[model samples]
Target: MNVPSNRPWPRAAWLTLAGVVVLFFIYWSTVASTVAIWRRSETFAHGFLIFPISAWLIWQRRREIAALTPVPDWRGLILLAVLGLAWLAAEVARVLVIQQLALVAMVPALVFTLLGWRITWAMAFPLAFLLLAVPMGEFLIPPMMEFTADFTVAALRLTGIPVYREGTFFTIPSGNWSVVEGCSGLRYLIASFTLGTLYGYLTYRSLKKRLLFALASIVVPIIANGLRAYMIVMIAHLSDMRLALGVDHYIYGWVFFGVVMLLLFWIGSFWREDERVKPAPPVVEYGWGLPGGLKPMLAASLIIAGFWPAYAAYVEGLAPNNLAVRLQAPAGRNGWRLVAPVTDWRPEYKGMDASLHQTYGKDGRVVGVFLAYYRYQRQDAELINSQNVMVRQKHPVWSNVGEAAQVVELAGRPVTVIETRLRSPHQRLLVWHWNWLNGPFTVNPYWAKFYEARARLLGHWDDAAAIIVYTPYEERPENAARTLQDFLRDMLPALTAKLEQAAET
Candidate 1:
């Protein structure tokens, strides 16, 4: 039997294979389970399609993957370990699963490590294309919503419809129809872009063509979404909000989005070239018989390994004390009435000044609950006012009913008051009556260690902040409030001050 002499696998493949196995185990044991739970979350449930889509894409690219140059890379194994830990920590911290998709980190490490620097550089595009998995930049939502609303309003007006228009909203005298949150077209924009990207990649081999189609995928969705909103509003105006805003609204969107996507695919077909190409052989090299100077690399690997665990431990140790306390349920506090059972109420975490909550109803068929909390230790203040009202115009999935400010006294001290109301019917609302820190935050030693390690890598830290969200009957808002109060009470003043400073900046 003859083996390729140029192949470096005997030195590198076995190690990488072992590393891959270990990473897969870590994923299956921890990250995968957390991802499974995330699949049930509103922000990431769409990620359920990632695997199937990725599989299909890989299948399409099988010929390409097979043709890539193969080189041995023992060093990549270390990177593999590093990425695995990142994925695991992301899972533990309840980070957005899309943001943590292993392919973004792992695939690059695998490709670069084993294939040598030159080949990995050559194939950066396909490797980067894998990053479609990392759920990123719903940032497009605001702009997309703006465009959709503008287009819809204009289109409606052109059709001889009387409309009163403001920023992203308009009222038609035909009925009291305001293009609220759900109409913002964010869902369709995201869905269309995802599907469009897949279609572009599979069909267009040329980078230029792929990019053009990808841009079109993003643009067309917003246009189509606007049209969808216009149609629904027109229908409702002609008929009633019941038919448009009722059960049929989402069904209508799905139907229209499907049609628009079909059109996009049809238009995209014009750009594809099905030219034949010959199979290419993998380039291989094997000059280094033995790797040199292992001690420094080994030390570096060990040092890196300790990063996450240390951060996790620190966070655990710093875990804010839980100050469980019951706050009296308000029957009709500030026009927000309790329509559910009065059950358990306790502060869940100790970070902010205080938190308080109590349930107002039963489990399944309960009406609603009331929750309130104060954040003396404000974290991520920028995020508090980041809600894009214009985006809500087309995507009406998120609604800010209104907000009013009143000077409220807390601990007998006057503080700035902010209250915003958001209404989302389909989403299960949980009043996080406690620390609303964004991304990984927990005082568990393991979590703290993990966070610390990540900060060293990512080179940034997030401040602990508190936010109180209110929703219908989905969860016990009051209980959430209590949880918040306790957590805040336990968070020492020094830590609270640090968090506040972090947030202010």
Candidate 2:
């Protein structure tokens, strides 16, 4: 499959260019969202480089892309249509990550639709590499934190330093150390993985070696990150928390990463094969009917891709305003009476139009019932925003000590709720929370968002609320969870009605 890269050209390049123009408008919102992340998030700031780098990678193979025989594969259109639907669903669900990825996929899909599978296949690596542009990899932080803690604790113990390991915090004879989110080597892992993939593509022709090197890029960084955290802790421990405790910790971590990557590249140089890029061949005229040429393809592509945002726009225009909602506490039930919440600490429920905080007492224990009601759900005011948490990190007086899961009946059905054990200086608490997205109770924030998107798209009321239960625990997590469970069974009926009424009004 070969063709001339220069001169009079083929019909495919012109068609693909038109398709790209249509794509720009179709994915404008997604592009704006991704760009905002690149500007805002320091962690995903590397995403800003991915687009230009991908384009450069493709340009280095310009002759290869241009030389391949392009026969428009309608299969690409089929895939593109399917991806468009998926993107629509993602948009409706308000999952920015999913929608942005689907939008990025249009590049290859358009390539396939206009340039055919052959040309698209030749440029597959660069096309796939475009995914790094989306701001993702935040999910890696938790596991990275755990790995750091495990590695640091093991290293400390091996070095004959007395240590006690907890969840993310560990006690050492010299000082106390905790693996915070910053200590999680996610930034290193993402950078290493991205670089390693590109290096493997440019350096190796063999698939096996490419995969092996790419895997190494992933694996090495994880282990290296763990070791990096361990060394940083050791440096802090040895220096009596003077050296690595400041900005030097960041400097050391990045410096260590750079050295490790340099070493990786040096070793990979042994197996490095050239890209063998070639100049464009002499002009060879080729012609094929574009199934209606560039105009029709552009029109069809615009029609198919533009439908989602068009619908979203129409829906937004017709959506009702419900911002005047007033929230009230449910009536007392099962030997439980409503009382004022007797603490300064309030659950952080962001952008609530209305909220209810009532304390209920049964037997000897006091329970806090909080309902965060929103008349309409939007980006920041959504029921499941991360800002709406039991604790905020700025002051850092309270810490989530542990997680305890248990089954509890809600709305006449058994649902598993994630219970968290929180500890302050003087108080220990067990917290259970779930988002009431119309009806389904979900612990996952994203699922709540998905439900909100679906309901809103269907022209249904998008009113939602979060229900939180707090119970004091003495020494046992089980007792605290049991207290919450009993509280739910007694109060769920009235609570459900109250929430249902919130949506209705």
Candidate 3:
């Protein structure tokens, strides 16, 4: 690669660099958070390479970029402002994914604003590729896990092996297997998509071929993962659970994926169209100095980009000082009396300002109630968080086998709750949970975050709580569900009143 250092730096290049530096400093926290995730999560570790790859892509186009002249476009400021507001909204809601996306988006907006459309267009791919750095797609885990389980179980049955499945957990005669987060193939999908897109970009100049290859990259990994899972199970079954049950399980998966990827690339190679390099076009000669009115546009763009973080900080400062919070248990009524918790299962909720756990008994049935209350919610301490779940994947004492949204009557009105089923070696439970944001009940995390952001932005109390109700069952889960509904029918009004009183206090 020939370096171009003979000519002076273009004014647009200088301005764009300055804008990017400003953006980095203004959203340093978001940048740091993204890097932290990349470091910690094996699934998102690919993020570390995204920047360098994008830079390389840009470097490849340096000759073409040098041939064009840049003119600042004022319209970029409008995009900057929109993205800034979006970042602020994500900040207020404490949605890390959105915050990261908004921050990444501002880079292209800055380039566009400072370099105009033609120059921005010249570097569009590199700019757009930066978005792959964001650590997202966690929402796909459940569905992917479901598909893996379905495929593996169906394959086992077809092979004349009897299998029993419940949610992502399943049992074969040799041993038991559960498709936890590790088996969801999310890492595979992300890796394949990233590499495949990069491969398509490099190998095929045609848009149709590039898109088709990218689509194949996504589809192949998913199907390959399903096939990989089936083979792993087969190995375990054939070996009497001697192999592919522990460390080798992951090893086998990666080895299989490597083979599949190689096979895919080989197949795709037949249709590859290599770009023929041409001599660089002569660089356009223009005044090295900044254009008139460009300075004002740059200033305005920086102001628009910088305003969001400032407003976010101000809004954050408005959060009230943490106050001492105490929650009283709902009084038992209608023959249901408060008693010691019958089981040791508890929902995994952290950073709560207050928490209450109580068990109620009527006749032979026992029901448990748990509340994780929060006031002045903020990052790492909010009620709606991925960390707050029914059961951690690696928990030794429990496993979450199934969960879904369920609608049930509460205080004479139907309300949706997250219905979770947990299983242990000796116990089984059915749980119903929802977030109590101010006074409204919501099972959707997005809605809960929206309500929290609305309350905080409007200068109201950002009070929220995670409410969970559960009951133990031996065989019939429907019986346990009935027990919970009956208990809630009689106990919800008092529980609501107690929460209201706590909020008032």
Candidate 4:
């Protein structure tokens, strides 16, 4: 049979070139957003797995793709454009990068299709790997929470602690230690899975081992977090919530998770066999030396590099800003009275001033708590101590719950508020930072300090003070008052309990 001159060179050569470029571009666009989102939450951080996992899958197919001929099909640009538009629009909408991460996988598919590579059964794994970056783990939260809560409660009970758990939270009889949303293992679960998947893909050469490790990644975090919660509860029970360290639980969870994963990998290696094969040497047929026309491409690359910094700045400016402070209440309204003032006692911090209060409705139902502190500027440990007190107020101490804080800066300096509300039948904790009304600054250092203080508090939610820095606005006194009143109404119980806890501690 005569081969037609019109037919392009063998398929193997083309696919390899196309796949590499497609993979690079898929990762290139997401790099900035990925880093940003990862900084914010575990859900986003785990998204870093997409690249390496995809690379692993691609490596598996290198032999097959290497047999294909190079063919740059322009049709892929249309698919790329559509996907790019979707991602760009989502980014513009201020959607988290993890939400649009699925779009990253489309580039490779579009390239493969354009280059005439048939979609085969073998392509499924790589395609699946691509979707891992998307913020798809939320659906697993309820299940993860349920498991963690169950184990935590069981462990607490086994340790001779009187415990009552419902749904995602539990109550310890000795002190007000409530297992709440922030403690529900959602963040830890996501972080664990993310780390697990990446480690599994990178370390394991066997598919079975990789998949098993991935499963372990998902399961281990939940178990470890449960253990962390159990430990916290056990300590709280032993010492009347004395061990209710606010952020320290998170650190302990991570450490426990690390230990668990190490054990899992050790066990996995005993049964798993390595399956990677060394590649054969490349065969050169037609002589090709940069095609003697690399200048245009090189020039284009250089031009891109030169403008990239400015382009990055422009992109950042376009990125949606979420950390801005927006007060939703009116100030200057003094008619509001504390119906559930929780402040009975003050906890002692070596160098920090702490105050806590709980407000309630006239009906005596718990509203929320107001915990505040003033640590001399740059004195981080005191600031954190204040916040940990607030976090402990929402759990077993009070049946109501949610996360506890929103971070904003007063002026430009870092400040935080521990907010809790009984909007409906549930409690809500919002963590907010109040910047020192001056300029741009970083809160990470303060957060680290806060974590350290919580660890020292040693599982005592009450021993620490709930911290909220109110940013008073001269122009909106009415709004501020209304906001204060509203917040008071919501968090009265938490505040009162925190103050009381402090006194007892």
Instruction: List the candidates' TM-scores in order.
Output: 0.58, 0.91, 0.94, 0.46
Model 3 CA deviation exceeding 4 Å by range:
1-9, 276-291
Report every candidate's CA lDDT.
0.50, 0.77, 0.86, 0.47
For residue 366, model 1's alpha carbon misses the true position, in angstroms, by: 34
What digit string (tens of lDDT, one per residue) describes model 2 on residues 1-505?
2332433235666667777777877789888999998898778898888978987987887766666555554556666788787787676656778888888888888787666566677789988998888888777776788788888888888999889875677788778777888888888888888999999998998899999999999989888888888898888888887878778888999999999999998999899876665565433434332455445555666677777778777767655654877667887888998766655567888888888888998787688988888776766776765577777553468776555456777767778777777777777888898778777787876677767777777887677888888988778878877788888888888887888877777
Candidate ranking (lDDT, best to worst) = 3, 2, 1, 4
Greater-lDDT candidate between 1 and 3: 3
Ranking by TM-score: 3, 2, 1, 4
**Cα shift from native, residue 413, model 4 (Å):** 52
Please write out the lDDT profile of model 4 over residues 28-118, one tens digit for every residue: 6555555666677655665666667676777767676555433333344445545554444333223334225635555454444333333
- Candidate 2 lDDT score at position 179: 81
Model 1 lDDT tens row, 412-482: 34333333333454643333222334333332333433443354344344333443423343344445334
| Number of the top-ranking candidate, with lDDT as the measure | 3
Residue 85 alpha-carbon offset, candidate 1, angstroms: 9.5
Instruction: Tell how far residue 432 is off in model 3, in angstroms.
Output: 0.5
lDDT of 3 at 58: 89
